[model samples]
Target: MILHDFLPSGNGYKIRLLCACLGLNVTLKEYDITKGETHTESFLAINPNGKIPVLELDNGQCLSESNAILLYLTEQNHLTQQHQSALLPADPILKARVYQWLFWEQYSHEPNIASPRFWLTHNAMTDLKKRMLPDRIQQGHVALKLMDDTLAQHTFLVGDAMTLADICLFPYTHVAEEGGAYQLSEYPNIQRWIKQIEALDWFIPITQG
Candidate 1:
């Protein structure tokens, strides 16, 4: 498998992190999204949406969208006896909870947190983004608070065991302060959760491929 990705991207990092946890060997195809690399004709052929983190399987089929790839990897891992813990639980209720976090991350978390981080850190800010920043930051706090409150009740997002939900949210949430949009200090539970994830043996930094 090959991961078409940009190293700095949390979305790309999501797939990379999961592959590390699953002990999967996937070739990394780096792209400098800063240079419009993902928009090139060849990259476009892989994902018409022009996004990074497209996972190309051994048979040449490609999967786009980060959370979808996470689910795919976990499902594939479930079929083998290699990984001990299940990232996506078999219980219907628990699986639904995992799905909930994945959807919420895209809709409520990423747009507010990830977008502002990108705009500020990458020098991509504009007049419209400047106007949008305040509101995004506010909503980001709301999203973080929700995660914090939920995490305050359990070790991980869904329950005691770590699930796909934690992996999905960790990338952006851990580095949210980069663009001056958030302070992890304000969310103590989240801080603790971040530490717990980092201490895992297979954990990989976002900077890692």
Candidate 2:
């Protein structure tokens, strides 16, 4: 498998981290989004959306979208009575709960946290973007509160074990303060959860070159 990705991206990092945890090997093809490499004709052919973290299989099939790729790569790791997987649950209800968090992360969390972080890091905080910060911060806080409250009572999002839900939410939430507009210190449970993820065996650190 070949992974076309931007190293600094949380969405891309999710895949890298999962691969590390699962001991999966994939050849990585890095792209510098700042140079408009993702928008090139060839990349667009692989992913019409022109996004990073496009996974091309040995058969030439391609999969895009970070969460979707996570599901695909970890399919074999899904829960089974004989083999309980920490990455995915076997019970239907538990699986649904994982999906729920994944959806929420995309709709409520990523937009509020990840989008702002990207813009703040890549583009100067001009008057227009500055005006949008307050609302973005509020939405991010709301998402953080939800995660904090849930994590306070449970070790993981859906069940006693870590699942895809944590992977989906971790990338953006961990670095949410990078833009300097938000501070994660407000959510103690979240901070604890981040530490737990970091301590996992075979965990991969997200880095930029």
Candidate 3:
């Protein structure tokens, strides 16, 4: 399998981390998104949307969208049933909760957190991007506070262990202060949850050269 990705992208990092945890050896094809690499004809043929983190399977099929790829990979790993139950639980309702968080991350969380981080850390600060900051921070805090309140009651998002939801949400939230310009220290439960995720045996850092 070939994983087309841009390192430093939290979306891509989620796949990399999951592959590592599953002990899957997938060839990584790095692209510089800033150079319009993802927009190339070859890449567009693979995923017309021109998104990074496209997974080309051994059978010559391609999958796009980070979370979808994550679900695919996790579903492919049969060992997860005995070892990584939280990833995709057998219970229908438990699995639904994981999906709930995944959707919320893309809609409610990433818009405010990841989008702002890209503009603040990677893109040139233009008038429009600059103008978007206040609203992003406001919405970002709402997401963080909600997570904090939920986490104050549980160690992980779903059942007893970290699920797909936690992995999906962790990267953006961990780096929230960089984009939102609000200290994570203010959310003590979030800080504690961050530490818990970091302590996982197969975890990988988001930072990459």
The candidate that wins on lDDT is 1
Runs of candidate 1 exceeding 4 Å displacement: 79-84
- Candidate order by lDDT, decreasing, is 1, 2, 3
Give the residue spans of candidate 3 off by over 4 A.
80-84
Error of 3 at 200 (Å): 1.2
Going through the candidates in the order shown, the clash numbers are 0, 0, 0
The candidate 3 region of ten consecutive residues with least summed lDDT is 77-86
* RMSD, one per candidate, in order: 1.3, 2.1, 1.7
Per-residue lDDT of 1-209 in model 2, one digit per residue for the tens? Answer: 99899997999999988888777788999999878899999999999998898999999999999999999988955444432455777678888998899889889998899888988998856787788989988988999999999999998888668888998888898999998867889889999999999998777888832
TM-score to native of every candidate shown: 0.97, 0.93, 0.94
Give the per-residue lDDT digits (tens) of candidate 3, residues 1-209. 99999887889888888887677888889999878999999999999999888999999999999899989998998456544564878789998999999999899999898888888787657898789889988998899999999999899877567788888888788888774477899899999999988887877787541
Question: Which window of 10 residues has the lowest lDDT sum in candidate 2?
Answer: 77-86
Candidate 2 regions exceeding 4 Å error are 77-84, 124-128
Each candidate's lDDT (Cα)? Answer: 0.94, 0.86, 0.86
